[model samples]
Target: MYICLEGIDGSGKTTQIKLLESWIQKCGIDVLRVFEPTDNEVGKLIRKLLQNPDAINENFQITLALLFAADRTVLMRDITEAEALAKIVISDRSFYSSMVYQNDSEWIAEINKHAKQPDLVILLDINPETAVSRCDGMDSFEEQNFLASTAKKYLELADHQNFMVVNANNGINKVHDDIKRIVAHKLGMCI
Candidate 1:
């Protein structure tokens, strides 16, 4: 099973993933946890660009989108091997993020054509204002306007069957319980 947790910055995806990993392990399932912008060569370049966004021009969006697709390709190779070993792969982000963050162009779609889709996409939904207040420093895409736009885009892409939107404004335990319920249902497990 390939599960993806996605949300804007400060939406508590990492925290929730950690909790989910522990629970999955308790169920005797081997879980492989991975995050985008991995430590590989292309991922390193993407991280560098993100940290130093000012060094790049407007063209960086296209470059970053392609880089993300490249990174996903690398990740999929590993995911395939893990799946062959019967491991459940959980990713922090996936191509859905690119669809939300990158330019709405055919090039972006074409580049991600070969990327693997998650069996379940859990979207931690939170208002941009609340999400912004939860974090300290801001990244290139963490600004108020950008996050609001991204959140809107994510909502647009969210589907009922494959996409599970959980309200993250609740307390951590409540939010985690909601996610657990959804994931359990998807996996046909009694939690």
Candidate 2:
């Protein structure tokens, strides 16, 4: 199973992923944890661009879209291998993020067409204000307006079947409990 956690910045993806990993491990499922904009050179370049305030323009979005596609292409082999080894691969982000973060959705989809789709995308939905408050406000994308736009895009992508939405406005444990129930239902595993 390929599953990914999606949300705006500071939506608790890191926290929830850690919890999910431990819980799934206790459930006897070996997991392969992968993160987007991986630690490769290309990903490093992308990170540098994101941190540069000058790169927060329209042109930057296009550049980031391309970089993200390249990064995902490079990561695909690892994902394939992990699945072959019967490990359930979980990712911090995926091609879906490009669609949310970039301006031209159609172009983002085209660039990411070669990327593998997640079997499940769990969106941790939260208000833009709440999300920005949790972030350090250092990155180019941590502003409330940008986050609100991205959050809306994420909700539009959520289909409630494979793309499940969980309210992240609640406390961590409550949100996690909701996610656990969703996972149990989808994977037929006991929580």
Candidate 3:
């Protein structure tokens, strides 16, 4: 099972992924943990570009989109191999981020066609203001207005068979319970 947690920054995906991985392990499931914008060379370049908002002009968006795709192309191999070993692969972000953050959705999808699709996508939905406040506007991506638009796009993308939406305004424990319930039910895990 490949499970991905998606949402705007400060939506607690990092926190929840850690908790979920710990719990799943307690349930005797071997989990392979990974995250996008990985520490690879391409991912490092993406991180570098993102820190300078000036570098993210309209034309550069396409370059960022391609970078994300190239990064995921490498990640998909590990995800596929781990899943084949009966490991539950959990990822913090995926090509889905590119779909939402980048300008051209169709082109983003095409570029990421080689990426592995998640069997389940749990979106940690949160108010844009609340999300930005949580992260302290750490990067260009953490701006409230930008996150608002991105949140809307995420919700729109959530209308899918494999998608699960979790309201993230609640306290961390409550949000985690909801994720656990959703995952347990969807995957038929007794954990």
Candidate 4:
């Protein structure tokens, strides 16, 4: 099973993921927790390029889309295959981040054809203002307007069955419990 957690930076996704990982382990399931923009060679370059504002200057949209796609390719090839020891793989960010950042439905759809879809995608839905306030490491992308637009794009293109919007504005434990409930129903695991 592949479970992904996504949201704007400050939405407490990492906290929830950590909590969920602990909870799942307590349930006696082996889980592998992973994050995108992995630390591998190609992934390292991609992460550097994305974090550097100047790198986004030339052909912004195209650059962003291609970099994300490349990162996903590396991840899929290296980690998501049958050799994985854990029965469940949980990712902090997946293709949904690319779709939200690019804001192009057609592009996202095309990419989805090649990308592996998560069995469950938890979108920690938080308004931009709240999102910014909660975020710790402020980058250019953390600006309120940028976050709001990205989040709106995520909501617009997501399907109900595969995607869920959780109220992340609530405290971390509340959000974690909500996510646990969702995973329990989808994976039929004891909580």
Per-model CA lDDT versus the true structure: 0.88, 0.85, 0.87, 0.78
Q: Tens digits of per-residue lDDT for model 1 on 1-191?
A: 89999999899999999999998999999999999988899999999999874634667787888889999999999999999999989989898888887777577779999988899999999998888888987544538888898888888788633589999989899998999999899889998
Q: Give the per-residue Cα lDDT of candidate 4 at 51.
A: 70
Residue range 29-73, candidate 2, lDDT tens digits: 899888888999999999989888778788877888899999999
Per-candidate TM-scores read: 0.93, 0.92, 0.93, 0.86
Q: Compared with the true structure, what per-residue lDDT tens digits does model 3 show for residues 57-144? A: 8877878788889988988888889989999999999888888888777888888889888889999999987887788535455366
Query: What is the Cα-based TM-score of model 1?
Result: 0.93
Give the runs in model 1 whose Cα sits over 4 Å from its true position. Answer: 55-57, 139-142
Positional deviation of 12 in candidate 3, in angstroms? Answer: 0.5
Task: Give the clash count for each candidate.
Answer: 0, 0, 0, 0
The residue ranges of model 4 lying beyond 4 angstroms of the native Cα positions read 55-58, 82-86, 108-112, 137-142, 159-162
Worst 10-residue stretch by lDDT in candidate 2?
A: 137-146
Clash pairs, model 4 backbone: none
Between candidates 2 and 4, name the one with more favorable TM-score: 2
Ranking by lDDT: 1, 3, 2, 4
The TM-score-based order of candidates, best leading, equals 3, 1, 2, 4
